[model samples]
Target: MNQVTRYSPLDDLFRGFFVKPMDFPSGMPAQQIKVDVKEQPDAYLVHAELPGAKKEDIHVEIEGNQVSIRSEVKQERDVKEGERLLRSERYFGQVSRAFQLPYELDEGQSSASFKDGVLELKLAKKLAQPASKRLDIA
Candidate 1:
């Protein structure tokens, strides 16, 4: 059966305002890691958007069909003797996201790179192999 997908701008707007913030609890704001996954003929490309994060604060892990991306963001300012804070709205905390793929991934062949606050991962698909024979019950 053929399926058609629909795209809506309002959905994105509402999600950005509501759903994205819910990732943090107790009113403690945190940076949210948003990701986009694209599948090709032979591999999958994952693009994660992590603004205001340093390369050393990010970590990526792949196990079986699951892929996880985590990052920590820290922001601090030294106030002068006569300076007073006016307003601040930036978030500082750790955030992580995990997703599972339909196909097996070739971990050894997968590669990841980060630039301009975006992380890109190229995951190669593992070739399917026949399952081994099952042993009889004792």
Candidate 2:
């Protein structure tokens, strides 16, 4: 059996009037953080795009081989006596992203820098040691 689907432009228009844009069904505002990772011989490079975020509002945490990046963006606008807002697309909330490295990372040796709404992380790889061998019982 073949099923047919119907499209209605008016349905979307009516839905848009009642529902707020950027609204998620989960009720929690969605904040997505984009990131890129590159691997090098000695270290790994991570670049995260965080527009409208301040450096002081960004935090980086390293736990074992996982790296977590968290940031909050706040935006406020002052309206005049006779001003009104039509549409707003700016996001203002907390966003976090975590990544796991292929190898263990040296937390003490890692460095991070943020500039122009971009966060760059230089994660140093920990040296691999030989596994311990257990002695056989006599």
Runs off by more than 4 Å, candidate 2: 1-29, 130-138
Cα lDDT tens digits, model 2, 1-138, are 999999999887788675666644444457788999999998999999999999999999998789999999887876778888755656798999998888999998999999999999999999887899999999
Per-model TM against the reference: 0.70, 0.72
Report the error of model 1 at residue 91, Å: 1.0
Candidate 1 clashes: the total is 0
lDDT of 1 by residue, 1-138 (tens): 999999998887787685453443446555678899999988999999988889999999999889999999887876789888765667878889999999989999999999998999999999888899899999
The count of residue-pair clashes in candidate 2 stands at: 0
Question: What does the lDDT read for residue 14 in candidate 1?
Answer: 80
What lDDT does each candidate get?
A: 0.88, 0.88
Going through the candidates in order, what is the number of backbone clashes in each? 0, 0
